[model samples]
Target: MEVIISNYPEELTFPQEYIDNVKAAAEKVGELYDVANGEVSVTLTNNEYIHTLNKQYRGIDRPTDVLSFALNESEEPEIEGEPEVDVLGDLVISVERAEEQAADFGHSVRREMAFLTVHGMLHLLGYDHMEEADRIEMEEEQRYVMEQLGISRDDAKEKKAPKAEPQQPEADKKAKHKSGFIAVIGRPNVGKSTLVNTLIGQKIAIMSDKPQTTRNRIMCVLTEPDAQIVFLDTPGIHKPKHKLGEYMVKAAEGTLKEVDAILFVVDATQKLGPGEMYILERLQATKRPVILVVNKIDLIEREKALPIIAHYTSKYSFAGVVPISAREKMNLDGLLDEVKSYLPEGPQYYPEDMITDQPERLIVAELVREKALHLTRDEIPHAIAVDVDEMTTRPNDDVYIRATIYVERDSQKGIIIGAKGSMLREIGALARTDIQNLLGSRVFLDLWVKVRKDWRDRDGILRNFGFGDER
Candidate 1:
């Protein structure tokens, strides 16, 4: 295939390795379709450049990783006597979007670029993903092409995003870089973890309808062009019912003074209750600015959210009030704009590839716990705690994880294990799917149920579980 390259994003320095990977991917696609003699054009861009194209051509204002324009959409005879040209249409890849996605997926920019190139080439080859069958086929094709390139998800290493390091001066870089921390806090089940996951474009904090799902101070980072926001997903702030609850409340409250700003999220579906009032009172105690995030606005009428936003604004002098549906990703840009205003210009605190500070084992444990919370009964969820006993990689690059589910009672254990270990299998299956996504590898999850007998109230157990530092 004769691959033609267009101007790249000036801000990104494309390495020869990445360019070779892109070409290899396109050639692989062309060879499979017997289009080895055909011609194709590839254009590299950034989010700002692609946003205009997306808005103009596809009517989408947001930046996407890749956009394809297939030439064979229609056929028309030329008025002049001219020979037909063997050409596939344009393929535009946004470097910024690709970098963000690469970081989110725990892969290198080179691998992500190759994957996007393959995806766009398939589109030009008249393959689509508008339907389920087509999507599966396209995905299979993408997987095959990536495997041929030897940069599949499992093989991707931790590499920095493609950048213009030599071209850009230090003074310009200093002024452009912005990085800081922003703590997310609110009442239980207010979609704080969901908001963190949504903003980060991946799940670092586990989500559950049950209160106090996030028991730790999870640091989820969002890295954009010249900006990085560290989000501290704290445990929900509520009246303590047990030592665990006290630990959660303290962890949430302790973060107020240590961060750049606060995101005090509230559910739009419910009225201002005592729980919200408690959070509001706590916010008043903090000197840091708080951005009132009225989340879950999709559950009610758009107009109904106005009062909820107004009510919270009246309750306290929030730095900014952004009514957003974290689950639906509504008005999140406004939320980030408000957040970025609070962050000071500084050097990037974390590596571009690092999304969360939490280790693999902890994340795996949380994923398992999240699945248990979703699968079990209401009473069993609060009592359920997951501990990963062992985590090791097999010779074939697959992961082997043995974890135990600690519950307060033997009956709860029976409920989790189910008849003939059906429930255990179900939990492992569900958790394995998420763990696989999180790890980017096949996971073999082994689950066991154990009776810890009111571990939540016991400080020894709580300490063992990494929650004994409660004040």
Candidate 2:
């Protein structure tokens, strides 16, 4: 099937990997049904743009997580076709709400955006979570697909550390509640998401070397006997070039303001650069205590970590200077202890088992994007977006999904599709494997390619592409 993606709202920001995830999920679903060749349209928009859509389409008058427009209104899945491609209709997402929700939930915008896409696609395919039974079924399917795609529920808890001597009575009876926001900030390409994932001990944020890979504030909650820390993995702080860039910067900056502590992650192996300085300046403005985290220490010698710590300590009076490698998971416990010290006593924000607040569609989107980003290199990484148009379960127990991969230009489109459609095929294959792993059942995935002609810079396009909301 062919999936088309377009953006509205003039200046919405999102990672290119999200688009790939949608396409991958669709192909996976298509494979399960043994069907091919369908058409799906997806739009990325901001809150203002989506709000208009919500008001005009559903009469809700307020922006929601997502809205699906299914041209094929029939309740049954379309028959596998010949001359005409199945017209599954359009999926729209709110970039603004995606960003806000990411921060509120403590995960990346990519995950939130992808989750919305998947959720909308499921709705288009007739999956509803209105009742308890329906909700359980849907939740299972969502989690199944997510886990198959390598996304896990954050609710999984870890075994408590054994005490050396005896547990304190007060510490044992009272479940320690550590609830507060910890913002991780740095320039693009610094392992901020990796650090957050390491701290939370789950893959909540999509990790990539691509600069500015994270477009929203992703929340990952970590709980213990006495504490719960909500870690916000934000877009890398960088100079703005487009409206989306401005929004990303705003997301990172805003998170810093609202959080209880800031974990300023930096590449310990590299010398301090302009990007590091830029983030440091912002960190200075925050009244909350800032912990200078020199991540990637595993790449350096043990002696090297000390000098790096000394250099940063000289530059700023950080609340604490911590050196650890997020990739190697070194010194994460120490970092968590420091983060807990900054959190004030507050009511538990989530259940003890809860980890992240993002929905399944967003996580699915991120998984697709991660595959794409890993497969493609350089600037091409930034110009892509994925949209899941439809996700359905047939009577036989197999799942079918339809999605689109969007680009700003025809050349970029050509590159994505590759010669003889080889590149597109490779991306689809890679995505399907992940999706199959996620769903635990056969996935019939259908993929399509189209050019949206600079949709990233166009407001109407952004709104149509699900980049913003109505307000």
CA-lDDT, candidates in order: 0.82, 0.70
Off by over 4 Å in 2: 1-175, 379-381, 436-441, 464-466, 469-471
lDDT of 1 at 230: 88
Candidate 1 lDDT over residue span 1-471, tens digit each:
888876566555665766777788888888877888877899887888988987776445577778888886365344577655568888998877877766555557887888889888988888876443575687788778777777766545644575543554656533345689898999899999999999998888999888889998898878887588989999999999998988888888888878999998888888899999988887777888889888888899877877777887888998888889898999999999899998887644543445777878989999999988888858576887888999998998888999999999889988899899998899899999989987777889988889999999999998888786843
Candidate 1 local Cα displacement, residue 307, angstroms? 1.6
Worst 10 residues of 2 by lDDT: 155-164
Q: lDDT (0-100) at residue 335 of candidate 2?
A: 87
lDDT of 2: 0.70
Candidate 2 lands at a TM-score of: 0.62
Best by lDDT: 1
Candidate 2 deviation (Cα RMSD): 18.3
